[model samples]
Target: MLNIADTLHDWCRAARPFALATVVQVSGSAPLPVGTALAVDGDGNVVGSVSGGCVEAAVYELCQEVLKGDAPPTRARFGYSDDDAFAVGLTCGGELDVLVQRIDPADQPHLTAALGEVTSGRPVAVAQIVDGPEGLLGRTLSVSGDGSTEAGAGGGEEWEAVAAAQAGALLRAGRTGRVEVGGDAATCPERLSVLVHTHASRPRMLIFGAVDFAGALSEIGRFLGYRVTVCDARPVFATAARFPHADEVVADWPHRYLAATEVDARTAVCVLTHDAKFDVPLLRLALGLPVGYVGAMGSRRTHTQRLELLRTAAVPEEHLARLHSPIGLDLGAHTPEETALSIAAEITAHTHGGSGAPLSWSTGPIHRRQSAAR
Candidate 1:
């Protein structure tokens, strides 16, 4: 899918006037999450999706209305029931609230710059006054990774300070949502609800194996928007041709490679080389790192042996607890493709704090705690 910034960059470069429709709020099993956007240009070209395929036509019409000035920057709601007189409703049984606005570069300078930063692979957050007085409607302010503001109109320095601080916090969490903030001190009654949307760099997934399962998992990881790298000590097996989906293929010892490479809080390390010499050292380093996930694929017996080696290596008890040995969910997966699915599903569940239980036995919101991005 094309990201919001990609859509904006394409339209701006083409000098096209378009309307951007964003799903700013959703309730009850909505197809898409907040920050999902769809752009429609004057030529009726559509890019991106919000609500999957259920409400695009309705949103497209709303975009045209905003582009034609028939509607001001407006919030359109779609409910599950078709009982309403409106021509469109979400058949998927959910509620979606979308904000449609014309993207005029001359008027939305900060948004333009924010889009550029996003397209250039820099983290940025755009805070838009979604609800407030008429004068503040459609106003936006953006903050980049280095704590620099894109500089736009919203309120006085006080308001900017609060909003920028909030934006920075949300950026760190990679969260997007509405936050209530008061206007200038003198106009305390002038409250505003700002929607802070954060765009962060894609997370990384390092798979230390060149096996068939590693290849399948690499493809799945890339599909999930992760930068996947496949590394193995044996050059014969660690060729790019073996793992076509991987972003990088390195013919190096897993432990030596990880010692020199960068692993952040968003990186996932998969130790698939079940050989004791290779996986033992690799996993010892992986578990000690602050990476988001560290999984090693092996059998129950192999895992028991590996654990003994890690303990002998003096890996802290808490760090050993972080390892997902005998990796992947209990899906009875016997094939490479199915095993990949199980591993990827486990990683996703871990990342989102899921129970790995069936939805039939689940309750509460289907989406994760935080809203999804475009």
Candidate 2:
């Protein structure tokens, strides 16, 4: 949702005006969420997806109309109908309501500022429509890195400010929250409720081996939207040309670099160095912290040897268990890139609270539906 907002915000800021289409309501099993958006530029390019592909063409037509100023930002209704059995909407036969808004730069100060921060790789919110419909679909609550804020809700400033602050925190943390903005609790006329979806900074992947596997992880991490970091004790392999995709190629020791950051559940640490001398101590340091993922590469025998070494170094048996040795989900990959894919997949599963189960084997929650209802 935030990604779509950022793109449209860019379109508006550049004064290259675009049409913003968002799924405002859904009934039954929805293919997309209420806040799902897609931006259609003046040239008809799409930046994001709203449905599986169902309403994109229809939405495109609406987008053209919006750019021409032929229509107000109105809620579009589409569902399965008796007349159109072979309809232009979801094959799942769900109904969706899309709100197409023509964003004006003059009216969207808060959204513009928010997108500027996001494009600069900073976390921010582009809060839209909690109330009103004319510009409600474009109304914004934007905050800066230092927490200075601005919003267009004049008379309802305090309530909107509080909602924006709470929503901004959730956005910075990369999650979604529903907030109620009301001043008079006894009997408030305008209750500004919001479903704020956050746009967060990209997760970091710190690969602790500057070897062949580290090089591969760096490339794969780029596709996974990670700020990839390759670290090693030896400076030779950490050269820029070797891991060009990496955001940082550090020649520093793995343990030393790990000490500098608060490794959280969003950060992934891969110990590709199999040498117990370099790898074992680093494994202890990684699992000892709150990092999201800890993958160590080796055969089963090699893992056993590494585990014993960790124990001798005073790392608890339970802590050793946290290491994903013979690392990666069982995709049976042998090549370097394939192995990197398996490891990255495992990292994604770990961070998102997934069990790494096959989709076919999984019953409900077939995929993590990116929606407000979830």
Candidate 3:
């Protein structure tokens, strides 16, 4: 699985055989989502998790069974039991459909290559036949972001081609889900259910300031699985030592650095430099970009002044409205750490379309289905 690709690749390179238990489907309020995987090697060593400790021991035993030579690829389901509190199931009132399959680098070369691509930060997707005919079970179709595809041994070429195309579409959308293939079609007679798992590079978090708040925000960004970069015009303040959590520290003008950096719809831009000289140019450009979030830190008075300056500079009213001036939610935060939390909360709420209100005040489900692009 891409979540633990580095460790799996290491085990693979060492010629160690292992069994992977992947969560193919989830129902109800589950802790983990689909494509979450747990791997167990021949020596009883484990690398990843499927249910976040709720059903790990049972999955581990399933992995051991899969590791046996005579074992075939299998599926197992775990859910809460109203009558049996001691039963091996999820106590969180959720259901997980897990597929256990043995993986040997020599046998599953496509999977090994996919794992390597994931570790190298390249986009890759893998489609595995989780439910299908006995002969098709465990067969895989690997698709790269560049449109290249490979199929495992012993599957109908037409079926593999269709599966590969579906995998590529899911990969482009950055989603991990299921696709129904085969069955009374021209491709193949046997019906098959495939789980397509996409592995994309981490989203970017561009923090445009070298202040203490920027340092704290960078730490939170990294914890949220972002590839954080801190940039500032002041070379002395932008040193890596000042922001140890940032993946990159650039001593360049914020506007210039942002102009040269690659950003997508998932990128988050934070302008912590409240000064007019830095904030005007940077916020002007950031608000016009296609990034998911663009927030600037400042007081109400400063925000009014910045808006006037931007308006004078010919920035459109629509673009100016996109700016989250005086950034972060109203958390009554004063310390840098608490301020970072507020900013992170705002960014998350924006990304997930949350109301920025307390969950207790809402009546609907706590978790909303996220978009594939997110």
Candidate 4:
């Protein structure tokens, strides 16, 4: 699966066959999301995980069975078992539907190509027939970010096209989920269920000031799987040596660099300049963009002044409300590293719709199901 693309690609390049068990669906308090995978090679080597630690032993045995060639591509379900404590199930009281299949590069060229795209950092979605009629099981169709598609051999051409289109729609939204096709009068006559797993590029985290705080934030952002970029007008402050963890250190005007960069709905824009000349113009542009999070570093008084300045400059009230000025949670953080943690926590809360309160103080499900748009 794309989640462990690098290891899978390496196995493929070495002409090794492996069995992959991917989580295609989840219900209740599942710890891992769909698209999570576990792969087992012929030598009994394993990489990746499906449900943290629970249900892994069962999934691993399934992978081994799949690699032994005795079993065909199959689906297995695991859930909590109250009647039997020794049962092979999840302790978290959640359910997962896992699809186990073999990946041999010589036999599955389409999957090899898809894995190559994922390891190369290109956006791609692979739709596999998880459930379908005979001769259609394990059929795959890969859709690239540019809208081009390639279907694997064997399966009806009409079904392949439908799967490709569905994969493309899911890729555009950067989501991984299942789609039911066929059996419909408008599409195909046979019923088929496809699981589309999208491998999108890492979301961007644009830090608009290259200060001590920026250095700390760049590390945290990278750890959180963001493509971090630190930008500032001061060349001395924006050097690569200052923020070694940053994917890119740009010595350009904050607003100019931001205007030229690519931004999407998943991108997070953090303005740490704290200066009127840099913060005002840069934030004015960032607030208008369709980014996920836009936070600025400042005190209450500075935030008040910045708001008045933006209002005077004709910025809309709706856009202004989206800004998280006097940024970060009420963590009482003093050091730069602590401040970065506070900011990251705020951004995560915003993204996941958390109340930013302590878990002990909150009731109900600890893990909320995030939107597909995320």
lDDT of each: 0.82, 0.74, 0.87, 0.88
Provide TM-scores for the models: 0.84, 0.80, 0.84, 0.91
Better of 1 and 2 by lDDT: 1
**Over the stretch 153-267, how does candidate 2's per-residue lDDT look in tens digits?**
3535445666666766766566654556554654333566566655677878989888887788899998889889888888877788998989988888788888886555578
Lowest lDDT 10-mer window, candidate 3?
365-374
- Model 4 residue runs over 4 Å out of place are 84-86, 132-135, 190-192
lDDT string for model 3 (118-204, tens) is 988899999988898776787787999898997666544667887888888888766787888888668867788888889977889
Query: What is the alpha-carbon lDDT of model 1 when measured against the actual structure?
Result: 0.82
- RMSD, one per candidate, in order: 3.6, 4.1, 3.3, 2.3
Ten residues in sequence with the least summed lDDT for candidate 2: 365-374
Which scores better on TM-score, 2 or 3?
Answer: 3
Question: Largest lDDT belongs to which candidate?
Answer: 4
Q: What is the descending lDDT order?
A: 4, 3, 1, 2
Q: Model 2 reaches what TM-score against the true structure?
A: 0.80
lDDT string, candidate 1, 1-374, tens digits: 12568878766766677888887778877877777889988888888888888888989998888888635688889877667634477776678888788776655576777888888988999887677776666567889998887656444545566678788888876677778777657534578777888887778899998999999999999999899999999999999888999999999999999999977878999989899999888888888888999999999999999999999998889999999989999999999999999999999999878899999897766765454332
Residue 29 local lDDT, model 1: 78
* Model 4 per-residue lDDT tens digits across residues 1-374: 68799999889889999998988778887889877899999999999999999889999998998998846789899999998755888778888899898877777677778889998899999998888885677778899889988776554577877888888888876778788888886778789888889998888999999889999999999999999999999998889998999999999999999899999888999999899999888989999998999999999999999999999888999999999989999999999999999999999999879999998997666777645421
